[model samples]
Target chain A: DTAVSQTPKYLVTQMGNDKSIKCEQNLGHDTMYWYKQDSKKFLKIMFSYNNKELIINETVPNRFSPKSPDKAHLNLHINSLELGDSAVYFCASSQRSAAEAFFGQGTRLTVV
Target chain B: QQPVQSPQAVILREGEDAVINCSSSKALYSVHWYRQKHGEAPVFLMILLKGGEQKGHEKISASFNEKKQQSSLYLTASQLSYSGTYFCGTVRQAGTALIFGKGTTLSVSS
Candidate 1:
């Protein structure tokens, strides 16, 4: 079974369109995170949720919002997406915030 | 803060050795290593805690130096499967998420 799974492995939309990517983990972990990998392959953390509570919110733009309905799911909603938002988004889960994490396949978002 | 990685890229022949270094500006509580292929998710290699411990995985090993705030990943007898981008993630303190480095690209060719 896939430990961490995110829906919509590929997303292509207009520049101003809004989209959402859903993430779920069956690892029974307490912490989950969202990371963005740019063209340069630099992985940057965007948000962190622990036990359905917002923990780490990086310097991401306001258009990006993360919601955790329960401990097992964390979803990312992007509003007014721009061309610069084109990147690979990955969802991960860990027993603790600092422990080893398991990552999803990644969602490739291309904003035209 | 983001950790700095040295030798942005490395190319080695089969059975060769390579070293990838990661340094942090702040005090690091633990360091994590991961490897990612061309178009795949990053796989966890190992994690080193503050006590400056050394961990090994197959032909790959890593060392942590808390005082220097640095970690080194050593690849020995490199194989074709070892060709991938290696990333080092660091945690400054407890209850914090990992902050990854710029990453080091390693290419192993016959």
Candidate 2:
């Protein structure tokens, strides 16, 4: 079984549209995070939540939103997507703030 | 600021040794190392806390220098299966989220 899984591994959309990617982890971790990987393979942290509470939110655009209904799920929603939003979005989790992180397969989002 | 990873890529023959370096401009409290193969999720290798402890798994080892906000990963007697991209994640004590480096690509040859 996959330790962490994300839906719609591939997300293709147009500019000015809205989209959402779902992520779930069964590793029983309390902390979850969202990251965006640019074309140059530079990974940037967008948000992090612990036990459904927002812990850290990077300097991301307001168009991006993260929701954690519970400890096992953390989903990302993007509104009015732009061409710059076309990148790989990764969902990750760890036992706590300083533990080793477990990453999901990643969602490749394409915006035209 | 983003952490800097040196030797963007490396090619090592089996049984060869290599070192990958990661440094940050800001102070750091901990550093994490992970390996990601192409088309695969990154797998955690080791973590170096604030202390000067060196952790290792098999022939792979890592050291963290809190003073200089730097860390080094040593791959000894590298094997073909060791081919992958290594990433270093750093977190300052005042911050909870980790800032990752671009990554180091390692190719182990026969």
Candidate 3:
């Protein structure tokens, strides 16, 4: 079984459209995170949830919201997407906040 | 704060050795190493917690200097499979999110 998994490996949408990416971890980890990798390959943390509680929220735009319905599931929703939103979004989980993280295959988002 | 990585990129041949360094200005409680191949997720390499401990692998090793808040990843006997971008994630405390470095690109060819 995949330790971490994300749906919609590839997504292409028009500008102003809203979309969502779902993430799940079967490792029974307590902490989950969402990271965005730009074209330059710079990985930036967007949000993090610990035990279904919000713990870290970077300077991300309001259009991006993260929902953690349960400890094993975290989902990202983007509203009115822009061209800048085109990037690879990754979902990761760790046993604890500071432990090594396992990342999902990634969801490639393209805004045209 | 984000950690600074040295040698933005490196090219090495099989059997050659390379070293990638990661340093932070603030005090760190632990350092995590990961390697990401093109179009793939980042894979964990190792983790070095406080106490300035050193961990070794069959061909890769890493050292941590808590006082200086620095860590170095040593790759010996480089293999083509080692070609990827190496990232170092640092945590200031146990419950904080891991902050990653810009990453160092490594290319190992036979």
Candidate 4:
């Protein structure tokens, strides 16, 4: 079974369009995170949810919102996407905070 | 804060070895190593706790220096399959998020 999975592995959308990426993990983990990898391959943490509670929220734009419906699912919604939003988004889950994380296949978002 | 990685990229031939370093400004509780291939998810390699312990995984090993808040990943007898981008993730304290470095690209040729 896939430990962590993200839907819409590849997403190409136009500017000002809104989209959402769904993520789910079956690793029975309590902590989940969303990371963004830019063209430079710099992985930056965007948000984190522990047991469905927000724990870490980076300085991301207001247009980007993360919703965790349960401990197993965390989805990212982007509003009025910009060119800068084009990158690979990865969903990860860990047994606990600061522990080793298991990553998903990643969703590549392309904005034109 | 994000850790700084040295030697942004490296090229090696089969049987050669290389080392990548990661340094953090704040005191670290632990350091994790991951390797990612082109268009693939990052795979966890190993983790080094704050005790300055060294951990090994097959031909790959890592050392952590608690005093300096630094960690180094060592790859020995590199194989073509070892070619990937190495990333170092650090945790400042318990129950905190893991911050990652920019990653070092390692290209191993036959």
Using DockQ as the measure, which candidate wins?
1
TM-score of 2: 0.94
- Tens digit per residue, CA lDDT, model 4, A36-84: 9999999999998888888888899999999998889999999999999
| After superposition, candidate 1 runs with Cα above 4 Å error | none
Weakest lDDT window of 10 consecutive positions for candidate 4 chain B: B90-99
Off by over 4 Å in 3: none
Q: Give lDDT tens digits, candidate 2, residues A1-112.
A: 8777898899999999999999999999988999998787778899988888898888899999998888899999999999999999999998886788889999999999
Question: On residues B24-63, what C-alpha lDDT tens digit does candidate 3 reach at each position?
Answer: 9999999999999999999999999999999987799999
Cα-based TM-score, every candidate: 0.99, 0.94, 0.99, 0.99
- Worst 10 contiguous positions by lDDT, candidate 2 chain A: A35-44
> Candidates sorted by DockQ, descending order?
1, 3, 4, 2
Docking class of 3: high
Tens digit of per-residue lDDT, candidate 4, span B1-110 = 99999989999999999999999999999999999999999999998889999999999999999999999999999999999999999988888888899999999999
Residue B46's lDDT within candidate 2 is: 92
Window of ten residues with lowest summed lDDT in model 1 chain B: B90-99
CA RMSD for every model? Answer: 0.6, 1.5, 0.6, 0.7
* Candidate 1 local distance difference test against the native: 0.96
